[model samples]
Target: MRTSYKNITGLGSAHKGVGHFIKQRVSAIALLILVPLFLFQFLASFTTGYSGVMAWLGSPFGAAVTFLIVSAMVVHMRLGLQIAIEDYFGGAIRTVALLLNSFIALMLWLIALYALIKISFGG
Candidate 1:
């Protein structure tokens, strides 16, 4: 019988493997679908001019889709950054980097959501 170091030490991924991988992939797939839709909608809206664009954003469907796109993008970005930070950093620096990454992602996501809400409400 062969025993690995991980089994001997009981030190492994600390439960941050499969779930992280799944979440990252799911977010990526969501972005793949949402980005093109967003681009087409944005480009089409551009042809109609500013007011038309605003009108579309102000609509329920537009706001909802935009929100979804932003949410997925933020999630994907945060997870990707987290992986990079974890791989390259350690100890205090890793903690700081992770905290900063999450904070920045949350801030940006909130800002985007707020803008979407404002546009949806015509405010």
Candidate 2:
């Protein structure tokens, strides 16, 4: 048996790539479903005023859905950005970009979750 140069170079599989790929796809599907629900809720709440919106958020179902959408969106964004950074950048730049991407995602998620909790608790 003869091994090709590409195979011998060990550049074929990253092993963890599949996990990232699957997570990206799953998050995409989740966003696809959740986004429409969010938009509809947003549009429907337009005439409800601030109190109405707050009350809606206070519901268990509303809070859960809001959390799900934000969580999935952040995860999807982080994974996509990481892939782009890995593919285009190198060395310290890639590491820095990945770190920044993760930090931004985490911040966004935390902010969103905080808002949801505050609204749910009437704060």
The best candidate by lDDT is: 1
lDDT of 2 at 62: 77
The local distance difference test score of each candidate is 0.88, 0.87
Predicted candidate 2 versus true structure: per-residue lDDT over 3-119, tens digit per residue: 965577644566343578789999999999999998888677657998777776778987888899999999999999998899999999999999999999999999999999888
Task: Give model 2 RMSD, 1 decimal.
Answer: 4.1
Q: Among all windows of ten consecutive residues in candidate 2, which has the lowest summed lDDT? A: 9-18
Model 1 pairs whose backbones collide: none
Per-model C-alpha RMSD: 3.9, 4.1
Q: State the lDDT of candidate 1 residue by residue for 10-95, as single tens digits.
A: 55547343677888999999999999998988888888898989987888878877899999999999999999999999999999
Off by over 4 Å in 2: 1-17
User: Which window of ten consecutive residues has the lowest lDDT sum in model 1?
Assistant: 8-17
